[model samples]
Target chain A: MLGGGFAEAVTPLNLLLCLTGVILGTVVGVLPGLGTAMAIALLVPVTFQLDPTGAFIMFAGVYFGGQFGGATTAILLNTPGQSSSMATAFEGFLMAKNRRAPQALATAVLGSFLASIVAVTLVVFFSPLMVNLAVGFGPPEYFALTVLAFLATSAVVTGDMLRGLSSLGIGLAVAMVGIDEQSGAVRFTLGSTQLLDGISVVVVTVGLLAIGEVLHVASRSRRAPATETVASGRPWLSRRDLSRSWRPWLRGTALGIPFGVIPAGGAEIPTFLSYGTEKSLSRRRGGGDEFDRGAIEGVAGPEAANNATTATSLVPLLGLGLPTSATAAIMLGAFQQYGMRPGPLLFTQESDLVWALLASLFIGSAMLLVLNLPFAPIWAKLLRIPRNYLYAGIVVFATLGVYTTRSAVFDVLLLYVIGALGFLLRRYGFPIAPVLIGVILGPLAETSLRRAMAMSQGDVGVLVDSPFAVALYSVLVLAVVVSLVLRARNRRRAA
Target chain B: MSASVHRTTPAGESPALGDGARSFWTGRSELFVGVLVIALGGFLLIRSAMMDVPSSVSFLGPRFFPVVVGTLLAVLGVALSVRTLLPRSAATADEAGGGDGSAVSSAESDSAEAGARSDWKPLLLTGATLAAHLALLQTAGWVIAGALLFWGVSCALGSGHKLRDLGISFVVSAAVQLAFSAGLGLPLPSGVLVGVF
Candidate 1:
């Protein structure tokens, strides 16, 4: 299966798409305001014509390549493109400031490449086990899983619990628009023929992530973006640099895997944790002012952690049909767009597509390394393009991407309305991920819970009867408790 | 008109923008959002209550999940309102070694760094452009509508050379039309150019 997957992925069409995705991801990653999620969102609609395997292959490239681009910007420009790259910017920028940008870029590329390869390799081996676990999942277990997905995503993504859940509420509300699938009752459609088909996931995602982002950036202060120049050199590692980075790369991978599987709000936690670990470890080793100075370990660790999570997060999305992050959520939408659900059963049913996607991850990561490593200085030049033209192009693509989905101008109009909501949400301090998550997962979650309830004659206790459901609830409770305790301890320290 | 970008400043500039800034609502957004959510929740609950249930066997009907979501949304709205009104501790303590980054000030800080003063001019311009694009999409078609959108947004974002931006926009839309049409087999509306392609 793996060998067949590799043969399919290496096809000219898939390879070209993979390259295109990698390049697009890197471009967005280097430029601020464009995130990996938004990049994927724009493509979800545009890639509507491609086979699922090819579309996913591109998505994976964008996912991996965005990190490389984000790290470059973080290092050279002192601005992390996404939250996942924040820790990378701290030490990465410092390294650039000290005239070590090439080394920093090199470390990031190597680290990201190694981390993704490690994580994807693990997927190649253990996905069957995950499939077996997923096959056992009844509706109740699935319901509990979605519940954990929502609570954990919100809890981890935002500072305020109320705001986080509120974001989810917004998504759930949007999802509830259109007809009830079971009852044949049109719920939120106020009487337009267009309203009958419920909002498309592509429309919702493109609106929020793409068009909404354009408006959000427009609303912000347009101060000139300042970035450090990527020093012109071959972005190759030195002997000491290689030795210093490999350990952190491995450590970051280890730290990142659990978070990716658990859906604890993408890579933000693990990246920070890896950075902290590297900082303290450096101190213990009595490295001289390396924390304040450009520490290679710092950039290496977090970049590795960030990319590792991007790779491993797919496990839950593919293996269990659960999305652990916004990108994964959008990808799940992409899967459903293809008239398929990604689960272990998918491995058996549509094994070709699933295995092909997995195989392309390897090729995609290698392509990212090759594309980003030597040409770090060139990709950095993308930032020099006026922010206006970049955003303007995004607006065009967002329109085209959405309009192409169903070829309906009405859908384009719906895109703008949702885009306005997206702009409003981002303008305020609301998290956008939950809205997308809710739109995609809300229907599935509702159905699963309803099915479980129906099977058990409306006994609420049935939700907790399964050991898997109980374990999911326990994990969720533990996460909440841990976060609360941490907050309290921090408050005491502050006082 | 130029100094209107700084809405807080006293010196007169763009009255159009000053009015927009006022109407758009600033500073009390949390309250606005809270109220909006509550109203939405109320609407949801009322709708679900009035919804026709199809009779079938073993359990909770379709209304059950809507009720749960609606009630929780209202509860969340109330929580948001209360939090906004009250002075809360530990909100400020989010940064001081909060153990897990996600546990305290992780993503909020990252996103907050991007948002500063709400500059309404560009946003309003972009919004108007979007409206125009939507209106033109069916009649003027994807090529023209897309070009207008691209050029208009570029203008909003501070590009001054109109003809250059328009040329580039046309080139972009045409290229997209050709690629999507030929390569992917998705037919973009040609509008006036219907038979030309």
Candidate 2:
């Protein structure tokens, strides 16, 4: 399976798409305030013309490239392009300031490469089991899973649970706007004919992530401090540095794999966990560990952990049709846009496409390593692009992208409206991930719930009749209990 | 807004009053959000009630989920508002020193920084520019509308190179229109240039 997939992915046309995606991803990732989510949102229109397999292959490249590119900016400028790379920015920036910039870049690139390989290999082997489990799910089980997703993301994605919940609620409200499928009753359209078909996820995603981000950044009065360019040399690691980094890389990979499998947010937690673990492990050594002073392990561990989680995050997306992060949520929307739902049936129905996409991840990771090592400095120069021009360009592209989809001006207007909401969400400290997830999952949850109810002849008890549904609900309850207990303990400690 | 700021403060402890007022406003923005959410919930409930589901549909009907969602929103809205209006000292203590406290404070400071010196001039200008582009898009053509948007955004962002920006905006918009409309075969509104291009 893997061999055939690799052969498909390595085709000349697919490889070129991969290159384009990685290059584009790196540029987006290097820019502060531009992210993988926004980049992918903007790319949806461009990919509409391509076959599903080719498009996904490009997306896989973009995802890997985005992560690697974010690490570059985090190291060079102390500005993380994505939240997952925040941990990397800690020691990475320190290393850059200490004139070990090349070594830090090398560690990040190599660590990410190594972890991607491990995580993708894990996905290839383990996704089948996940698909097998999912194949047995009934409507009740799926509804339970959706509930778990909603609860997990809203509860843990943001620091403030209320804000997260509010975001989720807003997303659900947005999701409810179209005509109800079962009853054929128009729900929230306000009698508008244009809205009879419902708000497109593409419009919502682009509006919230891209346009909203632009508006928020524009509203800021203060300019970011000018970044000092760090000098780069050949990206070669010394023997001792290599020896110190290997163990942490493995440890971080171990920590990150589970996080991707769970419906918990993104790689942020695992990366931080990896960093903390490396810090403690170094302290236990009680030697010249340099934990505070730009420890190589600090950079190595979190970089690997971040990449590992990113790779494995595809598991739930591919096998269970569950999205755990904002990017994954957008990817889910992308999958749906192609008229293919990514779940257990996907393996049997479109096994070639799925395998080829998985294979592209491996190919894209290898391309990223090759592209990033020698071109790290060149990519850093992207930072020098004028802020005004860059943002203005984004505005133009965003408008163009929104307009191209369905060629409707109403969508363009809706884009700005949603963008404004996005601005408020950001300003008010609401996590955007849960909102996107809610919008994507809301309809599915409703459908499953209704289907389950109909199946049981309106017997609510049937929702918990299945063992899988019971287990899922049990886990949801346990998650809430554990979080409450942990919060109480933290409050006690703080007091 | 500044008048509200002035009226909210009392006489004696002007400095303390200012700090308190700032925190009060910053801390209570969520109050407005909560109220807005409640309004949305009320609207949803009213709309769902007004929805005329066919008698042939399932017993559950379309209103069931919306009703549930609206109720949840209303409840959550009340909870959020109550949380905001509670005694600040306790809330601050709980939020400030906890494990996630750093995250909260950092985010607060970030918003504070953006809020403190927020120049609405640029924001409003950008909004106006977009509005103008929307109005002109069909009549003036993609080239003109896109150019205006680009130029207006650059100005709003405080770019000093006016002539250069205008020139570049034109080129950029023209290139985009050409690429998208001509190269990619995606039909952009020709507007005034309908015959020429």
The TM-score of predicted model 2 comes to 0.94
Q: Give per-model TM-scores.
A: 0.93, 0.94
TM-score of chain A of 2: 0.98
Off by over 4 Å in 2: B1-27, B94-117
Per-model DockQ: 0.37, 0.32
TM-score of candidate 1 to 2 decimals: 0.93
> Which residue pairs in candidate 1 collide?
A76-A228
Model 1: per-residue Cα lDDT over A1-495, one tens digit each: 899999999999999999999999888877776778878888888787787889998998888888788788888888777778889988988888888999999999889888999999988877888988889888899899889888887765455566678888888988887878877777766677787778889899888878887887787667755855647666778899999999999999899877788777788889999999999999999994888788999999999999888888888888998888887888899898888988877888899988899999999999988888888878877877888889899988888888888888898898998888877666556677777778889998988988888888878899999898999899889989997887677677758
- Model 1 per-residue lDDT at A81: 76
- Against the native chain B, each candidate's TM-score is 0.74, 0.74
- CA lDDT for candidate 2: 0.81
**Per-residue lDDT value at A184 in model 2:** 87
Best by TM-score: 2
